[model samples]
Target: MVINENLKNEIEERERLERLYQNLVEKMPAVSYVMNLEKEFSFTFVSPQIQVLTGWDPKDWIDIEDFRLKCIHPEDVHEFVEALKRSIKNHEPFHHEYRLIHRNGDVVWVEDFASPLLNGNNMVESYQGVILDITNRKKAEAELIYNAYHDVLTGLVNRAYLVERLNQILSRRHPFSEQPLFSLLFMDLDRFKIINDSLGHRIGDQLLIEAAHRLQNNLFPTSTLARFGGDEFVILVEGEDPRRDAVQLADQILLDFQSPFLLDGKTLFTTISLGLVIDNGEYTEPDEVLRDADIAMYRAKARGRACYEVFSKPLLDQVINRHQIEALLRDALKRNEFNLYYQPIVALKDGRVVGFEALIRWITPQHGLIQPSEFISLAEETGLIHQIDRWVMHEACRQVQQWYQYGLSSFPFTVSVNLSGSLLHQGNVVQMISEILAETGISPQSLKIELTESVFLETSPSVNQQIQNIRDLGIQLQIDDFGTGYSSLSYLQRFPITAIKIDRSFISRIDAQYSGTEIVQAIITLAKELGLEIIAEGIETVSQLHWLKEAGCDYGQGYLLYRPMDAESTEKLLRNIGKGDEVM
Candidate 1:
């Protein structure tokens, strides 16, 4: 056959194009290479950038495929080979980042992206790939991931990462094969807040770090310990019966804290409450398990701290009930499940209405007439108290405004609402109250705010700011159940409070014992000295009432005066009292 001019010209152009492509590959930033599938150490093409990235010349890689494999970090080589095998078998693209050993004896991160090149017959002919140096990006990513998953104070895995790891291990591909028995051990350091109070959080943090190191040393090598925020930790144990191993682990952990932690030359001691639960084998998801474990941990704390409890069905039931209540509360405002009942706060001397305390009642559709004591703390713990508090303020204010409009304007009755610690912590309590008062056209002076001593103790400076804001709005603040708390005179001055109510416990026993009488008198005298108004609670008997009146108590609230009643009954009772039909 004679050679055609057109065929010869086409060959020359193809050769030129091949040379241009090779030049472009050589100029690329990333190293480019091709290796034959049949050869163990064969490189058909190697880019010149290999010298710049790996300190290996292109001549050193060509025809030596094993050289690249030898340069792969030893720990990552097996996974890399397996990935390649998988890509080839599936005829798919592969991408992975791994450490590489450079010729300068330094480790560099590289991301390999390759695809199985197939022949026309649909067979994997070889792998065509690019290698990119992603060391700087990987370093940044690793730092971010570390910060995200670790607690800055103790250098322990945080709650988010703990949950992530738990989810990963509890998946269907769980590492444990012996029936996949695993345990989640939740630990909480006892009296941790006391440490922070006494020594400050700076020392508290050092103590936590020391405690973490001690606990970490005590855990089994396979066990994973995570700091689940604050002084809490969650340990995940695989391939062991939780009842046996968890108890032993808990015992060992308890021993770890036996030695005192010396921080700032001060010997500090802390104990832990542990709650462990075995995998129920019912395939209950990870979140539920963690929640139950946490509930059980709280139960352990309630059962006189520093003890371990194995989670039981009862704990699960309690958690489920709490969860139901939380869900109900989330929708309670929209469903109008809350109503306020006003209990009369009367002047003991005149036996006349002076103010009213607004108490919240939950009128749930499924569970009717839920008591405030039962769900009030639940609201605080679940972060629903802020909403509940706002609702009570608005509703109570609205009621007071309605009563004024209904021609009961001369009652001289102030509506006092209770403030929970959660609400105080919101930092917007004052703003919320101002908004409610503005919306309801109720005078801030008529909206008295009452808080328990525990609320004051737990309230931060932000909460103090909120209280100040409320006070600036002309609202009065009263510390309820005052004598029941360990409050100092100095701390009392820190708050701009208008009143303090002697706890019912002190007054209930005023008739029962001399100590109670003396304590009640001391509380009244103390309140008067502080220039604070006094309210005596639980005045049931005439003798008790007379004693409180003599003690200079300004107000009284109890079943003796009148039990809490519905709005209609309260109005009827007030009318009857005005007509001298009832003694109250």
Candidate 2:
């Protein structure tokens, strides 16, 4: 009887331990499961978490006619079953992620892992594993991928994705008539900087978002638009005839900009320039393709903004030449390879030499006597103009001081230096000029700063104040190329301008049959009325000079009077003038 009681206690203890194991399985986060592999994955045991995963009770899952069919997503069921069969047959472990349909029709993502169970003889008996809800992790992964490929500001595909897609299209194209064609439209918004600076970055950001959305709606079905950052965008298109398609698409984008962008209760008008390149399917280089489009876009900007240009070899050559010249110019500045040629300005009445305009010359070792037209604009664009302008100012002032040593320091017998718009806006520009003049010991009255009408475009307080600061230094301020741009009367009334140079265009038209005579005469009359001096530029013929003289112009400078010469020749000419000898 004692042995029988001891046996009963042992059986009770064993049952208690089994219940403890079952309790732990039911409370676990993941579903602990066991399947009878003999009956085609028939479930012999399941944790309570299975109900949380599939919305089915464990007992109900056991009675279900087809539990796999009910819980597994239909599309993934076949693959899951095949992999399960292989694992069970080979006694291998398997891991997979797939959708599970809940009783409430919600699709849940799960990480399902299963391993074949073995008996004492090392033969497969059943399968057991767990299902983890990786739905949150999957969503996080998907979102990560989306963010990686898209731009943060514009929501367009970023440059990386665009390049990837471009290379793919390039690699897949056929070699002949059966091959497809693709084009890249590289473009940027013109005058965006003006708006961005005048307003704020907030307004600029809104404008970009709106513009991107508008451009997106106008793209071809097989095209991708990408934001290349900060006013620049690129489009990739595929078609039977990509060149023609590119034109149409670019036109549509340009047309979209015609309608003003309404941003934060402000209507802003802007235009874009486009560069197009058609792929012949012979290359798969992304950089080359992008570079070609960029080159074309710049050409469009050069020809004038608000237009598009197709890629050509000449454009590429021009870009390459420009880059090489830019590098050379930087070197030229450092090597002191630049020289100044003086062009004499003469009084119209007495044929007396008044002053000389300083002209820059780049005597490049590779290319002799590089003219300003070839590299001045490039310098301005490259932010190297400020340094070049400063050097020119210093040289001109020093030359005038040297002229003083020769007793040539009078009112109009000074040196005139051209000022770039960028230089004028540079910080403490007036201070810099004052320091240069103080250092060179050139009389402020003997140095005149010549500016174009672009200086008068904005009467902003800063611009006006800067102009006033320079004027306060007792240096002469004159407007250069007056008639070619906005000849605003406000310029005389607003700034400290003392003279106006009639543009070479208007001076070239000065004749007995001059069509622009009224314009020039009116400008002269306006200058005289404002108590400002007038100078006529580019007087090539005797008739043009005679007309300018007869028109009561104060001064004239051109080939008719005296061509630009070297400093030594200018000194000789000045000596003759001091001797009262006729220069004309």
Q: Against the hidden reference, what TM-scores do the models get?
A: 0.63, 0.89
Candidate whose lDDT is highest: 2
Give one digit per residue, the lDDT tens place, for model 1 in 1-584.
24688888889999999999998998889988787777763567778888888888788777565877888899999998898788878888988888888899988999988767788989887777888999999889989999999988888888888778777866765444546467889999887875676467898888788888888887776788899788888898875455566778888887777678888899877888988887766544678878778888888876767788888898888877877887887898899888777788888777888778888888998888778776887787777888788888888898888877776655567988888766665567676777898899998889898888866665555666887887898999999888776576776778899998888888888663333588778778888888989988777877788788877899999988877777777667656655666544
Candidates' lDDT values, in order?
0.80, 0.85
lDDT of 2 by residue, 333-450 (tens): 8899998889989999978887999999999888777789889989988999889999999998898788878774333488899988776556578988989998999878888999
Q: Which stretches of candidate 1 lie over 4 Å from their true place?
A: 1-154, 158-183, 187-223, 228-232, 237-275, 278-285, 297-310, 381-384, 401-411, 424-428, 438-441, 460-462, 483-486, 505-522, 539-552, 580-584
Error of 2 at 75 (Å): 4.8
Candidate number achieving the greatest TM-score relative to the actual structure: 2
What are the clash counts of all predictions, listed in order?
1, 0
Model 2 segments more than 4 A misplaced: 1-6, 36-44, 54-61, 70-75, 101-107, 118-125, 177-180, 409-411, 455-464, 483-496, 509-512, 516-533, 546-554
Consecutive 10-residue window with the lowest summed lDDT within model 1? 172-181
